[model samples]
Target: MFLGIDVGGTKMQFAVGVGEDVFVLNKVPTPSRYAELLQVVEEHCSEAEKRFEYAGKIVEMGIGIPGTFTKERVVWVPNIPCLEGQDLAGDLRTRLGAGVYLGNDAQLALAGEVWKGAGRENSNAILMSIGTGIGGAIMIGDRIVKGRRGAAGALGWLNLDASVPGDKNHGYLENYASGTGIAGVGETHVPPLSTYEIVAKAKEGDSFCRKTMDRAGHLIGAGLASVASVLDTEIIILSGGLSEAIETFKKPMLDSFIEYAAPGVEQVPIVKSELGNLSGAYGAVRLAMVRGDMWIG
Candidate 1:
C-alpha cells in the first residue's frame, strides 16, 4: 500500500491507496508547532493502519508540503512557519521506519491531475490552487517543470499590476486572487467571513459578495493569462476550496483571460479540477508508488 499526506496551511489530509482504490482517508486541522504536527502525523498513521488492518506493515510514504526544499531540507515555507529549515522527510522517515518522500504540494496536485484527473489527456498544463494563498505547478509533456530551485510554479508572486508596485500586503496575485483575497475583499462591506461563506452569500444574491468574487476571478484570469503567454499551456486546471465556486466567476475570468492572453493563446481550455480537494493526496500516493517502483505510467 502507498500512503500520501498533504500538509496545507490550514489542514492536513492523509490517504492510503492500492492500485486505483483509496482505502483510507482522513483530515485534521494543521498544527502550527512542529512537535504537534509530528504527533498528529504519527497518530494518523496509526489510525490508518488500524482501520485498514495493515498493522506493522511497511509502506512507502509520500508527503506533499506547501513549501520548497533543498537537499531534502526545507528552505522556504511561507505558510507553515515552524517547518522552515527543517529536515522534514528525514525526521518522518526516522519516526515511521519507512521510506518517505517529499514534494511540493502544488506540484503533487499537478501530478495527481496528470495521473488521473484533468491533465490526463493534456501534454502541457498548469494547475493552480487558489486557497489561503495561491499555489501553482507547471507540467510539460510527462514531467513537472521544477525550475532551477524548484520554484518554477510560484504563480502567486506573479506581478499583474505594475502601477501598484510595493504593495504592503502579500504578493500581487495572492493578495487579490486567493481565498484569503476573496475574504479580504468581502470584508469591505461587512465582518470577515470564510471563503465558503463569501461564496454562499454571493450565490444568495449579495451584490458585494458577488462583486468581490468577480474581482477575484478577473485577477486570477490575469495571472493565468500571464502564465499562458509564457508557456502556451494546453490546459489550466483550478483546484482548492475556492475553486468550488468556479461557476460564480468563470465567465468573467475567461473574459479577462482572453483580453490579456497572447494571440491564439486564449483558446486554451481552463477547467476545474476533477480530483477536487484530494488532488494533493492522490499525487502524493502516486509519487510514493513511483518511488517504490510499484507503478509506472
Candidate 2:
C-alpha cells in the first residue's frame, strides 16, 4: 500500500491507495506548530488504517509540502512558517517508521496530472495552481524540472513588472493573479471581501467585481504567456481554488496569453485541472511508487 499526504496552509489531506485506486481519504485543519502537524498526521494515519482495515500492513509514504526544500531539510514555506528550516522528511520517517518521500506540492500536483489526470496524454505540460498564492510546475516528457535547488517551479515569484522589486506582495505575478490578489482587487469596502465573495458579487452582475476578475485573468494570462515564451509546453493546466471560476476568467486569460505569446506558442491549449484538489495526493502516491529509484527534489 502507498500513503500520500498533502500539507497545505489551512488543511492537510491524506490518502491511501494500492495501484491506481485510492481506498481511503481524510482531511483535517492544519496546525500551526510542527509538533502538532506531526501529531495530526500520525493520528490520521492510525485512523485511516483502522477505518480501511489495513492494520499491520506495511506501506510506503510520500508527503507534499507547499515550499522548496533540500535533500535534508525544508528551507522555506511561506504559509506554514513553523516548517521552515526543519528536517520534516526525516522527522516524519522517524515517527512513522516508514520509507518516506518528499516533494513540492505543485510539482506533485503535476506528477498526479501526468500519471492519471489532464496531462496524461501530453508529454510536455505546465501545471499552474492559483490559490492563496500561485504555484507552478513544468514537465518535460516524463520528468519534472526541479532546478539545482528544487526551486525551479516557484513560478509565483516571476516578475510581472521589472521596475518593481519582488516581495511578498506587489511585484510578482502571484500578487496580481492569486486568490489573495483577487480578494484585494476592490479593497475600497469597509471590510475587504474574500476571493469567493468577489466571485459571488461578479456572478450577481456587479460590474466592478466583473472588471476586477477580468483584470486578474489578463494578468494571469500575461504571466502564462511569459512562461510559454520560454518553455513552449504543449499544454497549460490550471488548478487551485480560483480555477472554479474559470468561466469568469478564461477568455481574458487566453486573450492576453495569445496576444503576448510568441508565434505558434499561442496555439498551446489551456485547460482546467481534471484532478481538482486531489492532484497532490495522487502525486504523492506516484512519489511513493518510485521512492527509491527517483530523486523528487
Candidate 3:
C-alpha cells in the first residue's frame, strides 16, 4: 500500500491506495500548530498500517503541502504559518520507517493528472486549484517547472489589474477568485453567505449570487488567459472547492478567456479535474512510486 496526503489550508485528505485508485480515504480539519498536524498524520498512518487488508505492509508515502518547499524542508506556507521552516518529509520518514516524498500540493495534483487523469499522455499541461486560495502547477516538455525558488506555478500572484494597488499580503487573483474571496464579496449583502451557500443560491437563480460568481469566474478566466498566452499548455485542469460550482460561473469564465486570450489561445481546452479534490493525493502516490528522489528545489 502507498499512502498519500494532501494538505490544504483548512483540511487534510489522507488516501491509501495500491495504484491509481484509492482503497480508503479520510479527511481531517487542519490544525493550526505544526506539532498537532504531525500527530494527526501519524495517527492516520498508524491506522492505515493496521488495516486488515494492508496490515504490516507499506511501500512508500508522499505528502503534498500547499506552499513552496525543497526536497525535505518547507520554506513558506502562508496559509499555515506554523508549517514554515519545518522538515516535514524527514520527520515523516523517521516516524513511519518508510521512504517518504514531499511536494507542492498543486504540482502533485498535476502529477496525478499526468499519471491517470486529464493530462494522461500529454507532456505539457497546467493545473489551477481555487479553494481558500488559488494555486497552479505547470508542466513543460514532460517535466514539472520548478523555478529557482521552487515557486514556478504560484498562479495566485498573477496580476490582472495593474492600475489599482492590490492587497499587500495576498495576491490580486487570490483576493478575488478564491473561495474566501467569493465569500468576502458575499459578506457585503444584507444577509451574508458563505461561498458554498452563495453558489447554491446562484444555482437557484438568485441574481446577486450569480453576479458574484460571474465576476470571480471572469477574473479567473483572465488569469488563465495570461497563462495560456505564455505557455500554450496542452490542457488546463481546474480543481479545488470553487471548481465544484463551475456550472454557475463557467460561461463567464470562458467568455472572459475568449475576450482576453491571444489569437489561437482561445482554442486551448479548459476542463474539470478527473480526480476532483483527490488529485493531490493520487499525485503524491504517483511521485512516491516513480520519483522518490526527484529534487523539487
Candidate 4:
C-alpha cells in the first residue's frame, strides 16, 4: 500500500491507495503553524496505518504541498512563509519511520489527472487550477514537466501585460482569476463567499456575483491564452474549488481566449477537470511512490 497526502493552504487530504483505487482517507482543516501541520500528518498516518495494518507494509509515502519543492526535499512555501525551505521529506521519514517523497501540489495534481483522471487518455495536457491563486502543471506522457528549478508550467507567473503596473504581483495567473482573487475584489462589499458560493449566487441572478465571475473568467482566459501560445497542449484541465462552476464560465472564458489567442493557435480544448477534488490526493500518491524517472514511463 502507498499513502499520499495533499496539503492545501486551507485543508489536507490523506489517501491510502493501491494504484487509482483509494482504500481509506481523511480530511482536516489546515493548521497555520508549520509544526502543527506536521503533527496532523503524523496523526493521520498513524490512524491510517493502524486501520489498514500498514505500519511496516507501506513501502513508500508521498506528500504534495501547495508550494515549491526541489528534488533534494527543500520546500519554499510562499503562503506558509514560516515553512519556507523546510526539509519535509527528511522530517517525515524520521518521524513516520518510512520512505517518503515530497513535491509541489500543482505537479501532483497534474500527475493524478494524467494517471487516473482527465488526462488519462492523453499524453500532453495542461492543468489550470483556479483557486486561491492560479496554478498550472504540464504532463507529457505521464511525466510532469518539472523544469530545472521544479517550476515548469507555472503559468500563473507568466508575463503577459508587461505594461501593466503591478504585473509582478499577479504573475501567477491565479492572483487575478482565482476564486480567492475574485473575493478579494468584493472584500469590502458583501459577506465573503467561497468560489463555489459566489458562482452559485450568480446563477441565482446575483448581478454582483455574475460580474465577479465574468471578470475572473476574462483574466483566466487571458492567462490561458498565453499558456496555449507557448505549449499548444492537447487540452486545458480545470480543477479546484472554483471549477465547480465551469459550466457557468466556460463560454465567457472561451470568449476571452478567442479575444487573446494569436492566430494559428486554435483548436485547444478547454474542459472541466474530471478528477474534481480528488486529483491532488491521487497525484500525491503518484509523486510519493513513483520516482521521477518512473513517471516518465
The candidate maximizing TM-score is 2
TM-score ranking, high to low: 2, 3, 1, 4
Q: How close is every model to the real structure, measured as TM-score?
A: 0.85, 0.89, 0.88, 0.84
lDDT of each: 0.82, 0.82, 0.85, 0.75
- Candidate 2 least-lDDT 10 residues: 288-297
Q: How would you encode candidate 4's per-residue C-alpha lDDT over 1-297 as one tens digit per residue?
A: 688988776778888876456653878987888798789888887777688783345667887777666765655677666567777787878888777877778878888887788777887888888766777888766577776666666767865566766655566455567766777766745686766677778888788888888887877787788878777778778887778777667777899888888776557777777778888898888766674343331
Best by lDDT: 3
State the displacement of the C-alpha of residue 57, model 1, in Å, after optimal TM-score superposition: 3.6
Model 1, 206-286: lDDT tens digits are 887788888988989988998998998899999987888888888889999999999999999998999888999998888
Q: In lDDT terms, how accurate is model 4? A: 0.75
Identify the superior model by TM-score, candidate 1 or candidate 3: 3
lDDT of 2 by residue, 1-297 (tens): 678888888988888877667653878888999999889878877776677674454377888888888765888888899999998878978988878877889988998888888988887889899888888898886778776766677778778778876585434888888888887775765567778888888878788788888998998999999998899799899999899888888888999999999999999999999999999988887888787234433
Minimum summed lDDT over a 10-residue window in model 3 is located at: 288-297
- Which structure is stronger by lDDT: 1 or 3? 3
Of the two candidates 2 and 4, the one with more favorable lDDT, higher being better, is 2
Q: 80, model 2: CA deviation in Å?
A: 2.5
